[model samples]
Target chain A: MTAASATVLITHPTGLHARPAVKLTKLAKTFEAAIRLRPDGQEGWIDAKSIVKVMGLKLRSGSRLELAAEGVDAPDAVAQLRALVERNFDENV
Target chain B: MTADTVGIVIVSHSPKVAEGAADMVRAMVGDGVRVACCGGNPAGGLGTDAARILAAIEEVWSPQGVAVLVDLGGAEMNAEMAIEMLDEGRGAQVRVCNAPIVEGAVVAATEASAGSSLDAVCAAAEELCQ
Candidate 1:
């Protein structure tokens, strides 16, 4: 199986705060793929489906997001999550 | 939505603390997980009430099971009583986790939001103690 990956920039004005973090984790859970995320310089990847781990990352606005997923829906998971961040999660900012 | 998630109850000596913890859980976990809180005595003082805890469990009752968080020994005792008081099979599925109220509830609810099992959610709360 091939792993899908993408690098995107977070443009959320407040970064991945409560709502955005919750949204990200909840969306990750909807997919069958195992998705992981890390910041540009971070050496460890965190489970995107876990709210605690995702919030622990403390990602900020303008941060470079590195995402990768491997599983049945790897490609779709990476694409959708990338779009979500790029669109600022539909937040009016 | 809540059917697949484990339920959570926050038990504390202070009503404000219980409500505050529940607020944090909701803010972080969203509506995917069901959570209820009970604190303060009937006299409006610092104490845990078994009746209130029982009601809180009922409020967030889930077939998937319920995880209860408490602040101190007294709160734990009362929470256990409340869980035992649950009639029928509901009591069997309810658990009083040995973890801090605020942090445990938050982590447990977070795992529950992901459709984790009752044991998994309880384990997540216990992991915080380590």
Candidate 2:
């Protein structure tokens, strides 16, 4: 598969918390796809697979984020990514 | 030895939580001291196995004895398990203190990087208990 991907807007009120970022990074690394997180208005892309990078963003709840995944597993990756975020990182919605 | 840097381990149920704690530490201390973290799973994650966490702890503690900070009760269990799994020699160098990870990470990263001792880090954590 060509590097397929999708970007989802983060709608959780808390944007993303540390525990959630760690969960996202941990899940993201499970697939062959490369994940990059671009915080709103940020010039650089952080490795969504890196816990440090995810937490470094310090995203507050309700921030809009773009999650890009590329590689053979990009489809499943995108689906799972949406599930994780939609689950509000397993925190209360 | 007069310490130049300290090794820190953060434990939480979620790896992200632990990493988030470390991120805060990095902001306070920069790249001076080494930091590692592990999460406990009901089933467990791929690299989050016991061996992996123990190795992460040993890797960071290569320079000096490590000071462990735990976020939750389970974190304390994982830290102890990591220490127990260490080689007798390596295990001797580990110090798993019941310090406040949220507070201790900030203080340890800042003070330890500034040449503070593990005792000082523990003291900083103790202050949070009050």
Candidate 3:
């Protein structure tokens, strides 16, 4: 199985709140890859596709997160998620 | 009015609570689900109004049906009464779900956005109880 990963900074002023968490979960569900995310130095990763889990992370602005995906579409999943974070989840930074 | 997308209504004694919950659901589901909020009494006090609840149900009514989430107590009774006030055929299309308002609305909206049936939406919302 292919694996891909990226470390992204949370740029949204409010961080990974409910709205962005929902957007991330929705995007994660569109891929076949097993997506997981954790704080840059966190011990364990949580399923990125679960809104509840993602929101529970309570990532704050400027927090660094590591997004990892493993599967046939791992590379694409990682790239898309990275872009989403870089874009500030399409919300005003 | 999508054939398979069930709508949702949130009922609470406080208008702010109902509207805020609806906002949260909309944030999760985007524009894909129909969500309405009905709160406060006819006198504009902190109580659930059956007429207001009925109007909310109608506002989001779809052939697929609607699920009502109430914030406990008289809110549930008002929701049920609102459903009963509808024509028999239409009333049968609505359900007063025994679920927490905020969490239930979020779950129900997400499920309905996926084109789930009324029963499926209610079941999804009810899962929050577990």
**lDDT per residue as tens, model 1, B39-82:** 99999999999999999999888888999999988999999889
lDDT of 1: 0.87
**Native interface contacts kept by each candidate, as a fraction:** 0.42, 0.00, 0.12
Please give, for residues A1-93, the per-residue lDDT of candidate 3 as tens digits.
Answer: 999999999989999987787788778877899999999998999988665577679999999999999999999999999999899898865
lDDT of 2 by residue, A1-93 (tens): 545455566767767765566567657867888878787667898877655556668787667677777888887887898788877877766
Which residue window of length 10 is worst by lDDT in model 3 chain A?
A47-56
lDDT of each: 0.87, 0.68, 0.86
Across B9-50, the per-residue lDDT of candidate 3 in tens digits comes to: 999999999999998987767887899998899888999999
For model 1, state the Cα shift of residue B2 in Å: 3.7
Write down the worst ten-residue block by lDDT for model 2 chain A: A1-10
- Model 3 residue B60 distance off true place after TM-score fit, in angstroms: 1.8
Per residue, candidate 2 scores C-alpha lDDT tens digits across B60-115 of: 77445677777666566666787888876777666766556776666555445545
Residue A80 alpha-carbon offset, candidate 3, angstroms = 1.6
Predicted complex 1: DockQ: 0.41
Backbone collision count in every prediction?
0, 5, 0
| lDDT score of residue A6 within candidate 3 | 95
- Order the candidate numbers by TM-score, best to worst: 1, 3, 2
> In candidate 1, which residue ranges exceed 4 Å CA deviation?
none
